[model samples]
Target chain A: MESSRTILTKIFTDYYLGAAQAKKDGKPIAYVTAFTPVEILRAMDITCLYPESYAVVCSASGKAGDMIGSSGMGQFAGDLCSYSLISLGMDHAERLPYGGLPEPDFMVATNNQCGTTLLWFRLWSQRKNIPLFMIDYPTGSENTDQNEYVYRQYLALIEFVKKQTGRDLDQRVLAQQAANSRAACKLWSQVHVLNQAALQIDAAKLANALFPIVAARGTPAVCRYCETLIHEHSRENENAVIAAQPSFRLLWHGYPLWFLPKRYPSFNDDRFQIVLNDYTLWWDLDYPAADTLESLIRPYTSTYLNWLPQRRIDWTEQLVRDYAIDGVILHANRSCRRALAHVIPLRDHLLRQGIPSIILESDMANPDYYSPEKMNSQLESFKESILAA
Target chain B: MTAVDPILKNCRSMVLNPHHRRAYLQSVSARSCGIIGYFSNYIPAEIIAAAGFHPLRLIGCFGSVSGPALCDPMCSFVQDFYATQCSGLADLLTGLVFPNSCDSLKVLRQVWQTRPDGPQCWTLDHPVNTDGPALLYLTSQLRRLASELAAASRSTVSDEKLHAAITEYNTIRGLLRQCYAKVEARRLRYSDLLAVATAGLMLDRNEFTRMLQEFAGSSLSQPLSGNPVMLAGPLTDDLELVGALENHGACIVGDSVTNGWRYCSQDIATGGDIYTKIAQHILSQASPTAFDLHRPSLAARAAELGACGIIFLNQERCEPHVHSYVKCAAELEQQSIKTLLIEVEHGRPGLQARDLMRIESFMELL
Candidate 1:
């Protein structure tokens, strides 16, 4: 693992400098949340900024948690709640890479987890005196309401664009960006889909490529970057079924790429291939850039982990059949309770549907909470259960 | 006390009929009769009577059978209350009054505030000591809570009536303290004291005092072991947790928990002094409730009340208690008072295996 200083330096050099350069060059750089509809932002020619992204940068740099803890923000160790503390302490945790914490014209509060997070953002907006545009979800509604709520949040996307950048939410731009996002998602999905053939790319290439998907989803550069990979793969006929894509191609949920990066290779054993993860997929698929906001974002595709959670569960169902996987390693994440709670009923349902499911408890960040030995033991026994099934 | 007391009878029936507890709550909500919630037995009786609502002491989940859940068992109990609230069982709680003694109650107040139906809640920021800003805070919060309760219950927080409630609660506190002494000295089993405590539910303060006197007679069938096990954690009048620990090789010797011990001697004064004792006692009780002196240094508390071992039952997710756990453990160990730390998120769930293991290990060392 890279040290905190190294990660901070890299984030500073790449995304922050790039965003600053883009802003100076008269190309608009609108920042949205991780939970915000990137297609909507892309349509407005706005760049995305996940507040949580800055939060992670602060936490990894070892400032966010400490400052938050010391600043009477909260007792992370006391509550054993890393999520609340990290978020409450995001601002003072570290220096802004792009200088002054991405003075985006507006901020968004997504109600995916506990509504307290929304409250946290509200207090933040009050403190910062920023217009905190809300991304409302249908409170406690499982799937259908969530999508409608996400769609409602999309309406604010246009309003925020008009307010922030003094430009109308051009439907043409959204549709074009949606198309670009779809193309990128397709490429990204192909990259994951090719994992069925195992070790399709070198470890370094795969790790480096994973970044553009996570951090640069709606960017033209990312679309071009992924497009190159697709073209290159097509020319080479790469990803030949490497040892019949392990019998257990598990869909590892939670923010794996960030929280428990060490556990990344824990699934690398021959029999179990962690086929798709939620971290990067949170950004894939934008609408073809368009004039109308509705038409623009209409072409956007989403996973269950997306604002479209119906799609999340639906994707799992489809993957269960399509991938012919034997089990699901439901790495139940504590920070993302909105996502983790979904797994309880899903676990029961999957069991009835004859799919093996294992729920392992963990906090997303600060690997201290995750017991790798315990999780590995659980999976090993669960593998036996699958074989028995 | 009143001929048309729909609330008091409702609370009694709910306690008696635990299974129908959920249904009874719906009826309370149907009438828009607000619930009066108290965290512990230390609750002032006059306040419940004045509030004109059934006093509800929501107990922890009922058993320890579901131990296999990876998380702590108390969390299951807490989830039970949360689930019930979400399902609208306790929706009738128009207002809640609680002594600020534990973080669990603090979190519960937060949860109650956010429920679909707005339950006007007030923290009786009771002091851990009889002095300091806690006195001012508690008095002010209680006065504010009085008006809020009246609005919810469709009554007035008449000063005269409030004085009466304080007197009644003070009387119960006085009697409970005397009874607690007997219980502490092994003169009586805690069950006798519990009977007197429960009698506070139906009987008025003076009447309840007489009943307790009658109950705490020189001779009782059950025996009280002199071995004082100081019952800790946010307590309830429903000594289920205490009794369970007793059943599992422990006894109720002494307690730091306010539900029983802290509120025992409270004597709410009358007039401008109406909020006087309740506020004074509550604030004095707010110190991190372990061995009373920030753990490891509990000679003051232990010597004040003779105790052999300390049982620390922290309400799970109740951060303050959990923080004090290791420190309390080390401190009690220093005193050679083997401490049992039970992380109870909610009280209903029985002794978890992890807790049972902890207890066994502690007992073995002792």
Candidate 2:
């Protein structure tokens, strides 16, 4: 029987290979941002690829530095989003990974995640001379207005995909896909809940387990992968003997440092168990089945990073309480300004709530920004503080 | 030393000193219902004007102020705004409007709302795509903003008031175009042109128009001597960089910056549903670095200005302009046009020695 980690690796590998093959077979391939409506593309029978997820894979594989250097040769600034740099650099790179991403037939990006996606996809569109469709999600606005605005874009997106691929979207197929996405989200949520009950799962493992949900959320494969993930965790929870519990059960508050999977202290240490991360819960939303497109507006627009800081504070407090989290680790990801901007206030709020949190500054995909000496020192001090408390 | 025109001197003082600008707004606030502050060029000042409130563009402040510390990686423009707000300069305004222009500003808006005694805040959701649906959505957003502004000021925005405001701004835009043409023709100094443009953000539209009229009527046509260059970037209020470039033998003949030409390059059309027209005008303008598509060709603009090179200026930690520079630089290279990239920390007092040396070298290269 394949381990959950093996299954996740295979799932991502197969997806990339299949996409490369699909491009050769003359199938339409669309590079999409993480929070885009991939369900629509799936229902239309178009191959959807997430450059962001693939960038993470490249970072984990230790090839992101070369790719970033290639991008720099093209005059892309070193401070731009590392995920974008990785994708942009792939075109100029000498060695191709996974046969390189298929030249996008078209690109779809939603600003629900961050403003960087729009710019990154625009660069791709310009480079490939392909049509790019943007789904705008206005932050810090009224919910009704945001919903109406985003829902209108969803309608427009359908027309755009049809125009690009010459394929009509079947509403029934979309409904089924949305159903699968909802099921996967529910199962993923259960995994979080299960982790809260028993800290038997490794956070690094869970981060890899998140690929299916992030990349293929509206497909049955995600639902199956999530179920398998829940099963594995449940089995561990039941069969494992209670040894020495971790001294500190911490919650990570931003994107994981994908390039430093093995060296990340929380993953390597037994005394510190990273029980929850904000990244894993980003897609743990329950969608309503009544009106698929209309319903997507609320959950899609109201992503954790998309909300006001107070809502995130409240949600973090809830997670800390529910998960019995002892301390918090805030990854002040330099590449993600939207996420980084809210960290200080969040740290202050957590401090006021009597919750100890430490901020680790590093880029998600760029290893150049990661000072292992500094990180290890900070983690050592943080562990001591946690133990003292 | 050159004799500075009184109007230009007044504009320069108002732009260079935040206290002077604040005092001016305070005096204006006493005469008007209230002052409404806005950020970004995408915000329609006509609506704020229609509400009988003074529309002041917050171009940020110099140096840091005592405030809740934002992270170091946040853009300098946002940091400067927080400095201004924390310094109590923003207290003169009754409300503030923040356009969803960039990620940093969007985060600032959310964080600003968390303040207990902060002024009434409204967000204008600018769409990335400039199409029919986007126009409709933006129009709706503008309508909502108009209603909110009216409600805050306890007034109404009649079509007549809106049209009047539109005409006043259109006059300002036309006058600014004349000033830009003078600068491009090398008859006017870029610093003086910049002072006029920056002052417009702080001054009443009518007063700004009068100031420009006086400057335009003056026979100040002295062909400035320097290597002609075009400055392009996102929002910046670094008045000294313009002076620094000229000091190093580079005359900034034209600009695509938010605080410069992009502010007054397009005028809202009259004789229509004012909201729709305002939306259309904003969408049709050369899209800012924040917007995803329809970016105006910088190389073509540089060629039209007859610039020997293009100076791509970016604020430190500004991701949008940095990303834009990559594409624009490639395009300029293909055109055999020389380019220099300069990143400055906004609100810093002066240009770094390294940057000055780079500017000198770039000037020599051109």
Candidate 3:
């Protein structure tokens, strides 16, 4: 009869308790990323945190609006990508509220989502004085007949990990982990499919997505969490919404989901269900490794970012269709130019494809760059466009 | 077309197209006027269109399109003007436009923000269209600009006129989108697009539209070969650059640059919900590459645009995009996407020929 919050408290406590143990043992507790995958960092028993999740935490609250405008956020204002700003803004912000950069033995970053995060991480790690490991990704453009390049990165990552930990990764264990992660993602994808039709996004279900969509990618835990989320979604009841989801369903592109949660959470009502997010989709697809530790870092086993040029367009088109999403909201964040870089073209692309996309402008971590009331009005137009359609 | 067609060389003449003088320049000639625009992307296309004056891309070519001048930083193509010193393309163009993008373009604004011997140049002062201080500042600025433009043109933009202007602008946007779609699908070559984008120089929406619509209707077929080169370098890849690619039997396909995609949008609605339209347009235009830091970083969107191989171009000593080009090269390399980073400067003709030969070699790989 333990309450859900109580159970979550326990889970969080257990993880943190485990974290406390690592702290006691002087083992590093680095913040890992869905920018790459969960298993790569988990393999070494390092305490991991997903900035994507922290971004979500800010998304559910109005905290992100306040968190922006830090000196670090301003440094990247018109230069890097918005997600980098979000990660940096939040990463730096977390140090103030959630305590400074977590103590970590080593830092692992990836070039999966446009090398911005990797670049940002390089700067971040350098500033932190931590050992930095990068997982090279395959080019996302025209392919050479050689698939070896893709998997080559996987092997490289494996070697890097092994060198750092001084313990060779067992191929059998890595394959098992990959299988589990992929299975979890499949189920996560299915759960996301449920609310594809403007179904209301249940908060609990969204919370559950963290596991399969994020934590459990490349593992059975993802599938289990997805199934549980679906069950929880079915049992949920909502009457406040016009139907179950909003009249218009949308996806918040880039890192502003965290920045503008308070401004636009109204869209999360029962009338419309936003079943997927760029943040969630990235990790679910970019599981860094599959077979042996060496095989995992193979260049052919590239990241989602550099594996194919049309990957974002492909992903966006697929998500809009899969989720039957009506529109896209590009968080034209100031700091993370990388995230917002192609947003206009993507908007243009979506517009050409007849998707009603809107760019929601704001600084992911800087309040000086946002207007809640005005943003709400803009979203209203977006929502109205959905209703009108 | 010669071995190197004059894209950057005659950019100013292209901007100051006679139509602009026959219409707007007569007015500017009669009386002084303030001008505002972004260096490369915006380059006062719409403003020139509205003011009935000539709008220029401001690209410069060294005496020979043969050298490193073409490879200067992205902004160097227009705002930097190292080539203007030699090419003398600066004679036709006057004034500047600075909007929010990268630090390189922003600094250009500072340089012009206090020009003592030029047209009363102004900054549009538009920020990203998001709901932040930038938006608020830009909203106020837009209102001021509407009035300023009216004063400059000596014709107040009535609410009706604004609405019509917006719709007309939207038409241009729709047409541009059509062209981009064709480009995205690889149906059109970048060289074919040069005329259309060039037509925007000093041409009004109507004239540019006529040229664009004609091209859109016509069948100007160019093939993108096996090695569909996706290049990012200095400001060399202008219309002239596109033509150069086409001349070499390479179709300029997709691109990831401030002016390439970030600049796409219809005119803001003239009347109701004007702020929203302007907001959206500005936000869409402020993609990552807009800001040019000394060592700028790669935009994820560039990585998202798949090309067989990437060409990183930069102007020597440009500072910003050069660093960005290097970082982008490393990133592209990590993805197993081979990259050739080229450095160029204004007034240098020999370097461009070598770069072209080098490009031919790189294209051979794809």
Query: Which 10-residue window of candidate 1 chain A scores lowest in summed lDDT?
Result: A137-146
DockQ (model 2, Cα): 0.61
Task: Sort the predicted structures by lDDT, highest score first.
Answer: 2, 1, 3
Worst 10 residues of 2 chain B by lDDT: B286-295
Indicate the docking level reached by candidate 1: incorrect
Check candidate 2 and list the clashing pairs: none
- For each candidate, report its DockQ versus the true two-chain complex: 0.04, 0.61, 0.02
TM-score for the A-chain in each candidate structure: 0.74, 0.94, 0.76
| lDDT tens per residue, model 2, B1-366 | 334488877888777787778788889999888998898778889999999999988874543555655666678778877876776666887988988877778778877877777888888888888877788889999998889889888899999999999999889888888889988988888888888788888898887887788787654556888899998887656778878989989888898888788877888888768899999988876554245322468777787889989887788777677667767777778889999988877777777999999998999998
- Tens-digit lDDT string for candidate 1 (B1-366): 432133334433434344455565566545435567665543454566676765666552322323223222123334555555555455555556654443334334444443346565555443332333335544665666666677777888676777766666666677677767777666656644553455355333444456555554444446665346676664343345555666666556556654556556446555556766656544444353211323224445666667767777656654444434544565566777757666664525345667667665655554
Task: Name the lDDT value of residue A368 in candidate 1.
Answer: 57
What docking grade applies to model 3? incorrect
DockQ of 3: 0.02
Question: Model 1 captures what fraction of native contacts?
Answer: 0.03
Task: Assess each prediction's global lDDT (C-alpha) against the native.
Answer: 0.53, 0.80, 0.51
Strongest candidate by TM-score: 2
lDDT of 3 at A135: 49
The segments of candidate 2 whose C-alpha lies over 4 angstroms from its true place after superposition are: A1-6, A73-76, A140-143, A235-244, A267-269, B1-4, B60-68, B87-89, B289-295
